[model samples]
Target: METQELHRGRLIDHIQLVVRDLDASRAFYTAVFDVLGVPMGGTADDYFWADELFVSTADSEAAEGKLTGRHHLAFQAQDRAAVEAFHKAALANGGTDNGAPGERPYHPGYYAAFVLDPDGNNIEAVYHGEAKRSAPSVKVAF
Candidate 1:
């Protein structure tokens, strides 16, 4: 639980999901990330990452041989098209559709899609309509 520097946005700096199958999770994430415009940051024998999210096997050092419970993680989509593409990519990979791309009642302009990852985590891609960000993320150095 230590790092010299990290990029953070909104509420979370990073999140780690310890899974049972690394390859399946990797495939699912790789495809969706491509649609979301997030590059695969890096990979090791037991894990892979894209931006702030990390997927690892239970054997990975940080996982301590324990698999994580189901979790929900939502990624920001550039637009409604990105949300649709993300759903398509996820379904084509190792994901199962949880919800189709459409507007949601969470708030006005809440367009999103949801999918279950290989490990059954609820993964989502959402576009909150036209808006502006002060910065993409905050960088911390140590």
Candidate 2:
């Protein structure tokens, strides 16, 4: 018997996050989503909507005194303007700027911005296009 191949589309369904504090996670994600114009859904301690992905947070089980590196997550933006808006909103909502919106030679036409969430998670909003001569100026904290 031949096995059937499953064909799936390229959209993300959801993402799960194990956070120390559910309420804080909710607030961070809610603010981030609002900035990106993404609707937040689900009740506390279980689910929330971020972009097209549903994110959930649970208790962390790591040992004490050990540091866990930052977790990275990226969201797709409608355009360069949206990415810039998201970066601005994230800074206003207590997120730290990791990187500003700009072009990267690593990926062709990659314009993106990075932010560190309240829980130290790395979040990014990206748009794929050719590098523009004039891009929005974003303030960075030293």
Candidate 3:
């Protein structure tokens, strides 16, 4: 292993999710992502893309029903305004808000909003900028 490769930008390219029903998951992601102006990679089962990164989902066959844990997926937004738009769109598309758009001082200026997809997966939109001393904290009711 020479390890001589140099990376140009962000390393992550895509993320795949396993959902119980592909159709429901696809609708949820499409609607929420559409609000953020992310295009759906047309006619490819259940797949959506933002820039060069793609997020896809497929039917899961674990046989134990929906898996539960702290697993979550997050996307970086262009700005704080984009994050807020995503939150509003997600809620309108039947996604439950887990956390509203705001800064998490504990995480070093992490402005993010979280929503639970149709399959109960936690999805987040984040914008990381200059650190701030005080930022409002929002607790989601649903």
Better of 1 and 3 by lDDT: 1
Clashing residue pairs found in predicted model 3: none
Worst 10 residues of 2 by lDDT: 60-69
Residues 15-81, model 1: lDDT tens digits: 6687778999899999998998999966598988888787887787645454434665778888999
Stretches > 4 Å off in candidate 2: 1-69, 130-142
Q: In candidate 2, which residue pairs clash?
A: 109-129
Best-fitting candidate, scored by lDDT: 1
Instruction: Report the C-alpha displacement of residue 1, candidate 3, in angstroms.
Output: 33
Instruction: Score each candidate by Cα lDDT.
Output: 0.80, 0.64, 0.63
RMSD of 2: 16.9
Poorest stretch of ten by lDDT in candidate 1: 62-71
Candidate 3's residue-wise lDDT over 1-142, tens digit each? 6655543432222343555566776678778878987776745555444565444443232211333323356776767998999999999999888889998663676798878888777677877775442523333332
Give the top-scoring candidate (TM-score).
1
- Rate residue 138 of model 1 by lDDT: 88
* Segments of candidate 3 deviating more than 4 angstroms: 1-70, 130-142
**TM-score-superior candidate, 2 or 3:** 2
